[model samples]
Target: MTSPMEMDKLLHVAQSCAPPEAIQLIVQVTEDPHTHTFAKLAEAPTIQKLALTPEGAPYVQLLRLYTTGTWADYLSMAHQLPSLSAAQVAKLRQLTILSLAYQERSLSYATMCEHIGLAKDLRESVRILEELIIEALYQNLFTGRLDGVAERLDVHSVTPRDVPRTADTHNGHDAVFGLLQALRAWRDRSSDAITALDTYKRQVEQKYDARAQTMQEDHAALTDALRNVAQSDTGMVARMRLQETYPDAMDVEANRRTHSKRRSKRTRA
Candidate 1:
């Protein structure tokens, strides 16, 4: 039987390897009862060592797999770890929901690495927001019944009223509400626009141009909200000034561009 420490060392080595092999090794190590691989590693000395490594490249790849593997397995692992804060729990739940909806069965190893590489707190926040959007989508789209509409229309004939508004009714409204709530919770939530743009670019490259366009539009709307606070004053002059001053604020768009460049450089380095 392999000692726990030996299993840890081998797991580390496996994580350092590339591709399907790394994943395969992880599966094997996790299955080995002698390894104590099931134990929480959050406070382990090894975890600190791994985290201290530059950008946690190898460790993050492994952590991602641990967090997002088979749902039941991951959940069991999560329970073994240090108890999460309310915010952390919320975020993880959200991430799970979004992962199921949008990236289920198709999440790439690279994408998983990116998510796990994020600062722990930030990772939690992203997970929460993603899950929030997913729940909103589910609540708005799936749980509702169309029977009322059909009964009202009194015919099997296809019509606007008869057709349920899946995208527009649920996802659209929920997206707006959820985005606003998320922004309020984290004012410095980084650029939703930039995140959306990156996601869109990736999706487009993957031949999901239509989905990219929708994401782009959603990002644009959220970006506008980020810049403009709702005000009670509605005088024509106030409205004009709001419109006029908005352009100046928009003109400061240079700052966002510069920030983006800096972030890209930091990531590359």
Candidate 2:
């Protein structure tokens, strides 16, 4: 299976070559299972230029049929347009199923039959529809079950068909712009949260530093008070020791002072 990228490159190479070769390549890409998208091919300048010519008109229409039209669409235009091969028809049917699945998960038998333009007879229509669905299952187009009793197709999942060119272009732009906006919003929110965290961290650090400084200052003041009390205690203790050692000398000094005062009073008398 060719990747979409390779298919796109092939498309450009086709358009660059002769007209006959280019149409052939385009048809192959349209029928390619992996080449499910067609907006780019349809919009290619070479294809558009060719489509303006008489010979290239029908082929361009065929590409559009595969791009946005269904099997019923082909049937309606079969008289005027080129017919598709068995594989291409099958793929178209599968693409139709995918489109239906996208619209609703539970598709009624009648609705699907009418959409695919199946047989009018109920029994024949159901049998053919079931066969197409089973074939699509093998192709991995979708995961679904035919609800015979309910007369519906219960779809679990489906590969998406290509978007119409107009819608594809518009939605592509919107999707890109929306993604950019979301990324910007996310960046802003993340930046704000980081800033708030840093601010809170700084506040906590400042508070801690202030508390630590206060503690140091109080410690220094307490140390100075203790040192002063220690010096005073040492001086009083030395004086106490000196008085204990000179007890008799201290008494003799006191008595001599008292006797001198008494003799001076007698002389005066």
Candidate 3:
């Protein structure tokens, strides 16, 4: 029999390894009476000398025995251990969510392996974490299945034919795996489209700005030429009016035009 403390330590180590069978075994031994007795014996001071014995029962069977025989008491005893590490707690949190989402008796080894592998990257891990949390909340708040006890809650087992071994990856959450993949792909495509649209918008804006600047320069040149023509025409009208009133003014204006024309020709030459 393992001491309560010893069981706790073993369970902790098992959880670190993230073996699916190990998790189920821990749950079982903690719930069983006969296993619990051995576990307690293992905790005894004299037996403690043999605590590290290699001949001890496999950890999973021990856990299963405890869980089956004394489920409630085993849970109470297990909870007495100091809390798990933050990372371990996080992993358990994910497991709890998956347990509810899949409606399984417990998280299977395949599912556990898939989750751990998928969670290797922080971004993907966080997303998986959130999905698990939401699934847990759904089960608890709406379904009233906090511990995954409902017989009908278990996910339907997939047929062997449905398995996609060609992908070269183990998929843990097969129920939602296809949807997740599609969503990720859509997000990537949408992001690329937005980037392309922004680039096109900048290019169009630059073209319009350059065209506007060219038009402004052309307008300024046309305005200066018009102003010069208007001034010259006004001077000609004034001279004509002065010539009608006095002929001598007309002669002076004529002489200025002849000299102005010569100067204009010389500048052009």
Candidate 4:
């Protein structure tokens, strides 16, 4: 069996020319003792080109696929087929669907059949989807399954395809401009986040300020009430002084009694 790399080389050569020349080149390839060349070819390309030729017309449309061509191009190529062989037509149809699956990811059987103008009847549409998936699997063009319950194609992988390279390559100025635009977008997002945070901080500060003011008012009122109570009750001040001057309440009371007794004795004497 040819390795994937060898097949890639063969396909690359096959793509370099029109169908006739491409077919010839692939056929002419041979494996040598020292030289590296692919010997075998897939018949799909020849079939695809024959299918692309229309009946009663000199024009031969060669459709590019699985490389630089778009989904639309593949579909157009399939539509161009005119009374080709069954196998040839099947190859082209399956290839077109693989491209479509790669693009859409998931597509309903009915919708796809309608898009590709498959059989008009419902039963025929489902049959077509199942057959196409089987063909794609055999060709290694697509890895997908039919969802009978959902009436859809569940695609896992498809042959790699890429957009055609554009001629207008960007220069240093374009790169710089792109970078500047990205930076501006980031800065704008940062500014918005900062603004939202500032607004939240201000709200929190206002709540904290209001709570602190209320606490201060309560503290002042309680202090004033304690002062008023001290002024009205003379005993409270005396008790406080006694507690400060004497170690015990009994000692302070004993001193007061001694002074009173001494004043009485002097009067008596």
Best by TM-score: 2
Q: Which stretches of candidate 3 lie over 4 Å from their true place?
A: 1-12, 15-25, 28-187, 235-269
Can you write out model 1's per-residue Cα lDDT over 1-269, one digit (the tens) per residue? 24567856775665455444443444454444333222233223444354455534344334433333333334555543334445434434434433333323233323333443333335464454434444534433112222222211111111010111222333235445544675675555566767888999897787777778886885676466544544434445554564465565445554887999999999999
Model 2, range 40-124, lDDT digits (tens) per residue? Answer: 6777778778788777878877777776667777887787666677667656776677678765789988888878777646798
Q: Report model 3's TM-score to 2 decimal places.
A: 0.27
Looking at model 1, the pairs that clash are: 91-128, 94-131
Deviation (Å) of 221 in candidate 1: 65
Q: lDDT: which is higher, 3 or 4? A: 4
Ten contiguous residues with the weakest lDDT in model 3: 158-167
Q: Count the backbone clashes (under 3 Å) in each candidate.
A: 2, 0, 22, 0
The C-alpha RMSD in Å for every predicted model, in order, reads 28.7, 21.7, 19.1, 17.0
lDDT of each: 0.43, 0.71, 0.43, 0.54
Which portions of model 1 miss their true places by more than 4 Å?
Answer: 1-48, 51-71, 103-131, 134-269
> Across residues 1-269, which tens digit of lDDT does each residue of candidate 3 receive?
23567666654554444344444444444443222223332233333332233433334223222222222222344443323344334434443334344334444333443443444335566455445444544433223222323212333331111122232222324424654675798799999999999999999999999999986885565456445645785856754555565465446556987999999999999
Q: After superposition, how far is residue 258 of candidate 1 from its true place, in Å?
A: 75
What is candidate 2's CA lDDT for residue 187? 100
CA lDDT for candidate 1: 0.43
Ranking by lDDT: 2, 4, 3, 1
